[model samples]
Target: TEMFESDNVDLKKQMQTYNGLDHPFSIGDELLVENSQFLLKMKTDMPNVVVFTFNDTSSWKSDMNIYKAHSGFTLEAQNLPNDINLLGKDAPSILQKDQAFYSRTTYQIIEKLL
Candidate 1:
């Protein structure tokens, strides 16, 4: 697993057993060994861990309610369309700014099956 530090330093540390990384990290940073099972517990709220797999994890799992409790929000590939009408002379400029914000919110979700 690799950690992108707040101070712009990238630390790559791979763990084999339970005596690995203890501190909170980002982006599914865990043991990279194959056929290994590990339990992850989020001790603090400051760290943001993002795990994005190409597979649809919810479909194969029979009970998703248990997994839902672990994650904050499991969002699928979707487009949140918002239509805002500005009834003023500054409509054009505001629309431009709004488009930029909308674009920022959007992210391309790559699915393995798709």
Candidate 2:
């Protein structure tokens, strides 16, 4: 399986920053979601979604290459329950250059909240 959360320090830092700015964002309450451009892992203990702002994540390129590779990808988020060890793979993520966002392309967030 393709793994997005590699226990990398930089990615961890980005996740921390995403949980900043005096705000709380959750899809269904207390669900911590570690996400890439096309993959997401959700946990109940942590309530956050790591947003990836790239058309493609270099990290999962190899994992994805294993498959035939279709035209588009899915916004996948598998639930990793309490104390459950898991990591992996999204939804439409909006990002503004003003804020700290992990991105590879040149794009801007039109509206602050969507």
Q: Who wins the TM-score comparison?
A: 2
lDDT of 1 by residue, 1-114 (tens): 222222332222312221122222332322221213433332222223333222223655575445432233222221211112433544322445346532212233333331
Q: Give the TM-score of candidate 1.
A: 0.16
Quote the lDDT for 20 in model 1. Answer: 27
Count of backbone clashes, every candidate in sequence: 0, 3
Each prediction's TM-score against the native? 0.16, 0.18
Indicate the worst ten consecutive residues by lDDT in candidate 2. Answer: 103-112
| Residue lDDT tens for model 2, 10-66 | 545544554212222345532332334332334333334333333333457465464
Residue runs of model 2 more than 4 Å from their true location after superposition: 1-12, 15-25, 29-50, 55-75, 81-83, 86-114
RMSD to truth, every model: 15.0, 16.9
Model 1's alpha-carbon lDDT is 0.29
- Per-candidate Cα lDDT values, in order, are 0.29, 0.35
Q: Pick the candidate with the highest lDDT.
A: 2
